[model samples]
Target: MSGGRAEGPRNIAIVGPYLSGKTSLLESILFATGAVDRKGGVNQGNTVGDGSAEAREKQMSVEVNAATTVYLGDEFTFLDCPGSIEFIQEAANALVGVDAAVLVCEADPAKATALQPWLKLLDELDLPRFIFVNKVDRASGDVQTVTEALQAVSQKPLILRQLPIVKDEIITGYVDLVQGRTYVYRESGPSELIEAEGDVADALGEARFAMLEQLADFDDHLMEELLEDIEPEKAEIFRDLTDNMQAGNIVSVLIGAAERESGVRRLLKALRHEVPGHGTAAARAGVDPASKETVAQVLKTYHTQHGGKLSLVRLWSGSIAEGDVLNGDRVGSLGQLMGQQFNKLDRATAGQVATLGRMEGIVTGDVLTGGGEAPELRRAPRFAPVFALALNVENRNDEVKLSGALAKLMEEDPSLSVEQNESTRQMLLWGQGDQHLKVAVARLKSKYGVSVETEKPKVPYKEAIRKGVTQHARHKKQSGGHGQFGDVTVEIKPLPRGSGFQFGDSITGGVVPKQYIPAVEAGVREYLSHGPLGFEVVDLAVTLTDGKYHAVDSSEQAFKTAGRMAMAEGLPQCDPVLLEPILQVQVMVPNEHTASVNNLISGRRGQILGFDAREGWPGWDRVSAYLPQAEVGDLIVELRSLTQGVGTFTFEFDRLQEVTGRAAEQAMANAAA
Candidate 1:
């Protein structure tokens, strides 16, 4: 999208970890902006941001929700993103179409690591973002400690703009570092301005100086003023803060209790006065501000119960009307979403997040143009699916309907993937984590009218012989018309692992007819399908040695029966064994937890190769290991738990290894069951 319509409206994303008060903040902002007369609470199941049935049922956001409001005569749209890591793709898709992000986080030091993933993402995008320390009123520790923890995980310097005012160990107010003024928070309405003295004044001086020092690092003039002991003006401080933040050189910090509506107005004012316009964001995204092309990016896609397909797009340049054709598809409708409510519009302006109706082929992260080819915009990185579930249709007749519904769900959520396993013959739904797949399953029933039974995917195991065996077998059948007779001898040998199955003939003197020999080989291959262990047999070779046939009764079918009988009787004598697939796994985590991860891998019958510092990630390590496919089913779940929810891993099939002991016994028993 081009940046020609840079002044239309600003889109901001509200992002953070789970239970960080983002939905509550969105509700308060909407209420303060007069978009809604009353505020909605997440616990009350009335929040405007998370209006979905699943979200309300769980009291957590499952996807990104958009709400628009007018603040200080400027129109703004806030994309409320889910806090759970499983749903991070929803935030990643929405962030690309926004001008800035407000990271809502709790005032707990222990939760600092949770912000690393979000900060790393914003840093990669070079998107200007501010940290909003929510629930300051309930903070158990000092705000400085919280900010310090946050700064440790953040790449950019954090400019503390405000300090919480504590009285009787409870936060009652805050001091604006720029304004050098203390304000007492009220139960309702704006914080009341108050005078500061003694310790309060002294603390404010130090905090303000600290903020100015950070800003001065980016502004030479401010640095000179500070060196010369000349106090900078409030306007000058604000100018530096805005410039540094918009330049992605500094991350500004604000504090508030969103549930009580405290600090909400101040947060809104900072966004209004400091957030760069959409034009700057468009330019940062590599779109030309002067181009006349009507370019937009699809931030989200939805399939409503009655409205068909709707694609939420951010109009980066130019305007689009209801009848305009985009990508050769007619714009059947145009509208905006405020929670679950839809406001119909005939046209949408630039820099606006609007919904295009009936955009059937459109998907999240798609770059759309009015005509011709659309410019290539940087797309969000797709996270590898770390968890999966085997789904079985509850009703046999719903299988066809289930496939169509899954396609629609996958369209809405790109992070989810579906695959039909050929070996196991099960439909597997893969996602970022268990919770992520669970939500997708819930949507299947709630949104698409499909009910499926879910279970852990079965391990695809195979069997092979440990030794060679030579056997001869004869098939004789007597019928009313004639008697059939065929005989053959074959040698079965074990090949090296991964050699697969091989068939050949060493017959001499025409002991077995060529036509009957072909039938014997086919029978042997078919018998190997279900070996003595009831699994596909691999890595073996069979040679046709000799056979006898009666000219009058010998037939291909008789030879085939003779070949099958030979294998069924001789394979048991070859000492058959089971084999399980192995995978090469690489676990990434902070160095502090490397040891824990190593132990975790060993406990699951994994062979740890080694670990080294993770490339491009400071203080992190990548541990490589070889684990059986069966051990990897819940590896991610335990890995995340061990690393405080920050660890991740990737795995691929390496080779098939022989399985023995109780593990093998259990696998065989389970297969028999």
Candidate 2:
């Protein structure tokens, strides 16, 4: 991959925890590669990656920002992924097309836990990755000790590629352990190589040997050489490091201060020499590069105010042209994505990531093939929403447009879900966390031109009878046209829980017309919809014992009116009770946090059913409980806080349980309001 398009572009993603300087590192890399004249800071908000208005205001990336740049005679496309857990899906989506990733993180040992989620994901994907300990200037503690702490969290072995050169408690530069050379930073330019001839030299030798030991564990030949006590050549050492990394067996650690542009050149050199090529990533994506069939996978979807839809895709096997028919639809004009700006392109070669405009139907994670063949792929897992809100548009007229916009939003990011709660009559938007929904709201306003609001969904509380009541109701009205008369004696009684509503009648001796019996039952059913308790009535029975009617004036309408009157007067007298929906929740958290989770459930008035080992997940316990629907609004927030942000659970509606005390009082008050 050269600057002149001689080789295919190499895709590299920069990912890490929030505020870990991933965007800053991207800016430093671009600056060091001469792709940009100056580096951009997050606070200044001029960085190429955080270009969106929401990102600028928040001073962090909220989505994946892919920028194409040429570095050291190689074509490189860098994917800057948001680090917040709220936007993890974006990072995971971008990883599908990238050859490798730069795991950016701080050097604070206390923050080592923050990297666990990303580490687990990378290990799951088996993608080759490098850890760039970013913001070293702000970091404190020995680099080796910090690396050890990180090692404990990472499944893959961590190899120290370079050691920080600290002078008087300050990071001055770095020493390349493999080459035994020291380099001093030169301010936005290339670092100057210096002689490693003292304590730095001694430390370099030891670190280099340690790195070799980690690498040798994966290479039999290297292990033999190490056991024989033979000094391995630098060429052999580099080859083993490169091979093991490309095989996803080891993670090489590098340190850098992206804000100062320090250690960026070394990071660039490592990327240029070590990152895997497109063919390897293609094979992993289940694509055959030799097949010569045009294939592409959408990494993202962008809806512009004027440009319609642009599907950012990566061509895996063959070239994509201005009007090539891919899968089903004809490809629109190809455009090269350089940061936030889009440049027109006649065609994009294999392995190049570009945007295809007017792709109205295409969505993220959709695989487009020339021959319409099913691409062997494990569909990218949808992001499980940790929080939800009852979403609504401001204007009633915008409801139709809002649904359409949400559909497109869902198409763009499958991590989000939209559901209509039939009982509550509210539309719910579920996603990762508050920030995720905030970005979605902003996009709805800016791109789709729709304004939306969100609130906690109303709990679907129900009402049921507690006591039985018998009453006589009469519908008698004498109009000048005809005399209307109908009378009924009915009984309302509570049934066993879960028995649902039942209607029965016993009209004998022609006391009431037989044809009017169904109309009486229909009236009873309609009145149940709006019970005296101001909620859906359930688990109750209405019985008709006897009734009288005037033959000439007693029509079905009159009989129906009489039955409704009977229930209306008798239900309130029967002692109606509020019933709250309880959910059968299975909360899965690390065993260490089981006590906290148990406390959380109990505090919410939940009954602990039992706890057991979570199926298929080691070291995690599943605590089953029954909790009221109202307490589940922000359960994910507390669970994450208790378990270092790794806890999750699944739940279903269990049954309706009678609620008492202040909870019932508040529910009744809210329903009245």
| Candidate 2 lDDT trough over 10 residues, lowest sum | 1-10
Task: For residue 360, give model 2's deviation from the true position in Å.
Answer: 0.9
Error of 1 at 508 (Å): 4.0
Quote model 1's TM-score: 0.96
* All candidates: TM-score: 0.96, 0.92
TM-score of candidate 2 on Cα atoms, chains taken together: 0.92
- Local accuracy of candidate 1 as per-residue lDDT tens digits, 357-397: 99887788888888868888867777889999999989998
The top-ranked prediction according to lDDT is 1
List the pairs of residues colliding in candidate 1. Answer: none
Task: Give the alpha carbon lDDT tens digit for every residue of 56-113 in model 2.
Answer: 9889898889888888788888999999888899888888888888898898987776
